[model samples]
Target: MSGSSRVLIAEDDVRLAGMLEGLLRSEGFDVEVARDGQRALHLGLTAGFDAIVLDRGLPAVEGLDVLRRLRDSGITTPILVLSALGTAPDRVDGLNAGAEDYVAKPFDIDELVARVRALTRRASAVVPTVRFPGGRLDPESRTVTLDDDTTTALSERESALLELLARRPGQVFSRALLLEEVFAAADDPGVVDTYVHHLRRKFGRSLIETVRGVGYRMGSLS
Candidate 1:
């Protein structure tokens, strides 16, 4: 692959998740993992990823439910469901819930890789980014540059948060929701506000709009 695919693994099985991560990394794919469904949904929604491998059974939220909600939110990223149930109905249920492919547990690693590659091949032609009048945000590089040709690097959390808001300019994201999506419930909601403040200093106060009691939104990039 000329470019590595950003893949998310939302499996509760720690052993399996580690193995998958190692295998995917070895294959030149950028991989990240979530131990439960909540983290899966958050990271999947907020970050820019090429494809997802979702486990049907997960804690905090079920994998199927996560898939459904992701689809509902208009995120059309390719998703492959991993499940122990491989009955006709099982595959049907997963497909009906918006999974692009279904793989029963105990799958061949090589086959899994092939399936993931297939999903990326069919991924939609949408590249996520946020641009303002004089600056642009690059999700992959985690950097932002302004009109003056000056650039600033962003922390992982900052990049994720900015990417999410930039993808939907003018859409106000509440602090709590931002925390969940960007920090994955691992950090406090205050982190959202703190990062917003930090970004304002770098990108200008107007670029990141505060929604008063609500959350924040990307200012007019045009």
Candidate 2:
């Protein structure tokens, strides 16, 4: 949290992102702006940033998904979810998705900067990988192994999506939650189905079951 705390601003709004960037710069924190979810994800995964200011309505990938993916991949950098959806549910969802803190939009730049500093100042904790029936999913490695014999690797998005379903085997995830929790808000809802399809192919057609107009869930290993 010194003059070297790097911050990533994942917001699509040109003006807001820029304003936040300038504010962080003035505060002596190294700042980077990612205008869309793709760039956000790319930078977030490849770069070593200290803290993140994420917008829920990110263009290509929703901010929550980015947060979820980062957490899923063992990137426990401090994160603050910044968005206009300040409803109780929205705040809960963002926090539940893995953000260390949540800041609603139209926020005071000074306050936002303070929160970012607070996040970086806090001590970090290690999040362990998720375990499911007949397999172990190591988010840090982005790999999954089923049946104790073959280990299958997943792509960035695939790993995030599967990690969501894998975290709770019997719990059904609605398409809306999938979009909010795993995919970008601007991303097509059908993208959930597509990823499910791909997961089916990778984990087997029966590994993920469709809930008939509801959503998808991790299928029973038996």
Candidate 3:
């Protein structure tokens, strides 16, 4: 039971998709559904999720294409392919296309839930801790530890923003880009400034740098 873990279900069968959503929700997982491959790809790239359940017969982009694109873009989220193409070759193709697990159609709902839980557990176990000048950030736990060893938990947005900057220190990121990628096209760009201010107050004023007439970048952790 991956309590509160987020999952994306890219399934086209309306009845099946809705059933899966209700199942995952009852298991205490946060779930989002995309009825087609195009929307699936968009959410897979822009949003963060613990696991993904993708259907091979998706319309618009096809499931394997979507899986390849996500992998090519460096998205490491665990994906389980669910489809009626249950042949040996089909299973091989799904696995070869970067799916962590493959579940054929007519799957037992309980079994599907178990596999998803396993994927989330494995992903959480392997997330690498990011180290910076004066601190370290844990991606799985969303916690930061300063040189003084004071640990603080960050909200999802805060952790995402800080991780983006810290991962590419000194690289500038514009507010528009941040809104699109981090906040998933938030209506107000000012939200970026608000989170930056929150991070500065929690960590320090110098934790991030503002680029005049441009955007923001990682600053000296001091």
Candidate 4:
């Protein structure tokens, strides 16, 4: 809380990861993302994050296994599990694996941000910066300044979406996947298109490309 808190996101779903990364960046938290649990685990050990947003279902290594391994190694960094599994049993599984918190899929961005802040605030040190293409975002400030010095205040949703895209530039994402990451479980699937429209209007049509029958892609030109 005193400085920028770093958050590592471990999720396989491309669109969902982008959404979360974008939202958290706007909240002033430094964020790093991994496409699967194996890469996530490797970073979890080698990368110094204030906390982590881990997905229970992951590729390469199961999220639970990654958490368990981290705990076994005595890494006490707080972990918040983000999963589509909403049942009590599933939540319990994540918690038992040493996660600091469990967030069900179809989560509210505000709620997710609150949890990340709470967890990171407990850390005594600031999370380090992880840079990528597009621009460097200060996770602690929640402000984004483009390469050309253009800047904007991202709504929680916009930030999350952008973060995910920044994680892997030029990757296409589907509307349904975006919906799952940014909106709460109660949001209707149709709302994803609306959000995308808003994002295109703000970020420019060229920044995020429509994939026709599939979904959307960022950094289409680069």
Highest lDDT against the true fold, candidate: 3
Candidate 4 at 90: error in angstroms? Answer: 1.0
lDDT of 3 by residue, 1-222 (tens): 444798999999999999999999998899999999999998887676889999999999999999998876556789999999999999999999999999998999899999999998877778756556678888789999987999999999999898887755646889998888789858999999999999999988788899998899777665
Q: Worst 10-residue stretch by lDDT in candidate 2?
A: 123-132
lDDT of 1 by residue, 1-222 (tens): 446888999999999999999998998888999999999988876776789999999999999999998775546678999999899999999999999899998899999999998888776454544554557777778898776778899988888887787655536788788878788966667777788888887766886887788878777433
After superposition, candidate 4 runs with Cα above 4 Å error: 125-222
- Report the Cα lDDT for residue 211, model 4: 78
What's each prediction's TM-score? 0.61, 0.56, 0.63, 0.55
Where does candidate 1 have its weakest 10-residue lDDT segment? 124-133
Give Cα distance to truth, residue 172, candidate 2, Å. Answer: 36
For model 3, the local distance difference test gives 0.87
Better of 1 and 2 by lDDT: 1
Give per-residue CA lDDT, model 2, range 75-104, as digits (tens).
557789998999999999998998889988
Candidate 4 achieves a global lDDT of: 0.75
Which digits, one per residue and each the tens of the lDDT, describe model 4 over residues 145-193? Answer: 6667666666767666665554444356677677776676636877777
Best by TM-score: 3
